[model samples]
Target chain A: MTARNLLLGLLAVLIAAPAVIGAYPLAVLILVLHYAYLGIAWNVMMGFAGLLSLGHALYVGLGAYVAAALYASFGLPALLGAIPAAIVATLAGLGIGALGFRFRVNGVYFALLTIAFAEFTRILFDHMGWTGGSSGFFLPVEHGQLNPIALRGPPVLFYYVALVMTAGAFVLARSLMRSRLGYAWLAIREDPDSAAASGVDVFRARMAAVAVSSALTSLGGVFYAFYYNNMYPEQIFSMARSIEIILAPIIGGLGTLFGPVLGSFVLTLLGEGTTGLLEHFGWAAPGAKQVIYGLALLVIVMVQPAGLWPWLAKRLRIGRDG
Target chain B: MTVYLDIVASGVLTGLVYGLMALGLSVIFGVVRVVNFAHGELTVAAMYMAWVMAGSLGVDPILTLPLIAAALFAIGYALQRHLVEPFIGRPEHEQFMLLLAVSIIVLNGLLLVFGPDARHVAVDYAYDSFELGPMLLDTVRVYAAAAAMVLALGLYLFFRFTDLGTAIRACADNLLGAQVVGLDVRRLYALTFGLGCALVGASGTLMVLMRDATPILAVQLTLLAFIVVIIGGLGSMAGALVGGVLIGVSEALAGFLLMPSLKSLFSYGLLILVLLLRPEGLMGRRA
Candidate 1:
């Protein structure tokens, strides 16, 4: 029940998943990993540093649009496109953090600030002509280019790429939790006043948290654009999209390393299963998945406020030290 | 010149209605100390209800306002008594999460029952406008604005003079003190929430006369309400009114001068400015 064992088991299943399953199921797995990556990144800021942002979509949209626009318009390589994507997202995060933190806009006020900024960005992008506006940006698929390094390939290749990214993010989150900055985040989360009184540079630590979290989230945005082969500001920057990203870490267990992964898998599998079942029975349920997610969040908060991962860890004795 | 005057006049009227929508949010925050993320969903639901009644019974939206408000009051009361009461004493973040859950449920549930298509209620005076001097104004806008102002004034007077209103304010100011004075704090919580829902429901009925009702509009409306609340100052009724009008006018002017899409940018920029320069809001009492 050690962390290493769990990770190894997960990797084995993922590596063998495409071989055993159909393309549709593999796509579902990719979706799960995508959310897992976002959840982990978001947790660093929200669960660790106590900055509740309901608008992480700003970074995701910014990254997606930048990468998509660059690749489509300028014919830039996708790998190199990530640099601008990450920088833009990070700088935007820093600007927002400075505006909010400097003004001492904490708690729900800070959350509102993030939502407002995201909405503003969405409207801005919706009108901008270069990024295709509401028409959407699509990366031209080079007919025969199977470039793994550039992140250009078939769905299966993208699936493995997503797995690798998710695994890498997991390691990053783990190391972060054990690092000095991670401890600082924990301190700030628990109590900013006490943490500052104890000589933790609260503002610096928070700004760093926002910067790192936003940078990581933008990578997922890049993957989303390339994997889906299109980027729509409306779809990527929607409030629902941001809510979807946060729900996984929340339901899995906020601040826990494996929580996002576990939550993502459970929610995604359940969602896919429900869709499959509905299709089989010949029923139409448009918002069923969201209904299920909402119920899951409510039940978790009401029944196990700390999240399912902590309770599961205790019962199963996995990561007992954690 | 006339065009600019028309925009400003319409903006002021719309601002009054916006303030009315935000009044319930401010009241709930002031009395219950919980931010209801589902407030917009409640408003949308009320709009749909008004729409249905207007369509079926052949009555005006104004006529169905009382009925929609009553129904929303019942729904809000039950939700507060059952779903929200347990978490009232928890941390602010936990309460926030609970309300967010409520928002998701209500929003998607509405989407489930009513498809994603936008529905509008047609009235006799839907497109009718009257000219005043060199400016023209929509009749519905003027009526909605008047109703909103009247409701705001009524709420302010009720809070000032009524015993139940005094008890609610007492609870807001000092939870323990209110309880020690033998006030039914739990009932008051439910009542406050119900009253807040009723106010929002009234606004929704008025809104259906002017705009289309879509499930997705709930989030936008919720954000708009928050903007109004923040601009006016949180937990202040008067602030909500002033803030709403200010935002409405600014948005109209922005749309006229810049582009229509940038109007939200103007409102958000105003919010950030107020947060940095005067977080207490224009009419909010210094705490």
Candidate 2:
């Protein structure tokens, strides 16, 4: 089957899922799609541009805090608040990218730089009074404020919104992968010095990747805040959170378009399944999900290396390049 | 002022332990060219082991040092030989991701076994402090710092003068060339990794003297070690010590002058500044 057809079929099933599945399963599906959105956003930078940022949570936390604060302080609509959140996250990404790229801090050093920035922002938020500091910020919900258009409604409503966002992100990623910028990002990823020698403008391409990826991630963050109705700096801007964002893309297949989406679904299901099994057996496994993720990554890296999605794609003859 | 001098003194002492924390990471990276993301977890595991020993056998945390070091050396050797050695020639990203996966597995495995609660080992002088003229010093901190200094110096000497250490350095400098010179590169890699873990184990035993052991502490320590190593230069032992002390003093000053929460901010800020302005670090040769 062609990749396009496979994606369309998946979308159809997802759109129809709310009708057949119970609320619990729908919530799980929402979580899966949430990760899919994040994974896709991360793939653009790490997979395509060869920029490994282990601290992408900086953008996510920034978007969440900004939208939540806007709603709480200025009584702005949460949907409208995402615009400013995206802008802020984009600017932050550009600043960080400029700092690292201009100084020639690539590879592992670049990843560490991203983590440091995220840590700095987390500390800043932890002490900021208006954002509620470590106490957390809660959004007020009124009796008549469950507007579907504004993303303030039931799980089903939010589920559809999440689906639309994920689909939109998938389309954006697909188009970007085919554009001139995408080719430039691939060249830079392979060899930046050679790419520059070939007149590809390495720094600009990298900065653009960071900017686009950060903006998309911020949108996911805004969605996360409204869906959860609260924001905690410790929870949102955590190293663990950043790790979780990258695992899907890596496991699905780095540098592939469908890898993040497929990986997110696989990981979320396995994670939820393991937790359910543990709960059913009356065992309290506090870190079972992480254990599963870690093991999967280890096994994949040791065995397949290219990730499950690309391997499966090759076997099934769906696409020549995942 | 006395306050300034006291803070500086405390910083230098704590810096010794931080320096020790970075030593193992530096050595591992120096020999194999692969950063061990699980390096911090090895320390956390050793701390837990020390805690268990102290609680069950009624021994001091310091007394469990030999057991922790021996056990960690074995684990590190086995890990490198079985898991990491195969990927030494792979792409750098694969190596990094593999180590990261190992870190996640070890951290979560620890959480599964020990739960999420923080565990600490109590010693006789945990809270005892002595006045040094105008300043006060915790006896436990002083002892831990002394131990750290000894270990750092020992490692420096080992790398400087020992035959095996010279072989390890040669492997780090040029892998194929080292092989051409008839060095048992694989065995040397495993030994270097084991030695690195032993150093971390020693630091972990000292850590139990001052801080609580929790699963989450692994990632924090890893990042701290990275900051120190980056500031000291990736594979430079002397750089790790100077960078560690500089970070320690800056953290103390930040906590004193600003909010306690901003201590990490100061360290991370300095890290970014160093990476931007001088990526070679204080004692490291320019790349």
How would you encode candidate 1's per-residue C-alpha lDDT over B78-105 as one tens digit per residue? 9899989999889777888899999999
How much is the lDDT of residue B34 in candidate 1? 83
In candidate 2, which residue ranges exceed 4 Å CA deviation?
A143-145, B280-287
| Interface root mean square deviation per prediction | 1.9, 1.5
* Model 2 lDDT, residue A155, Cα: 89
What are the lDDT figures for the candidates, one per model?
0.88, 0.88
- Lowest summed lDDT over 10 consecutive residues: which window, candidate 1 chain B? B278-287
The CAPRI quality class of candidate 1 comes to medium
lDDT of 2 at B190: 96
Pairs with backbone N, CA or C atoms under 3 Å apart (clashes), candidate 2: none
Residue pairs of candidate 1 with colliding backbone atoms: none
When candidate 1 is compared with the true two-chain complex, its DockQ is: 0.60
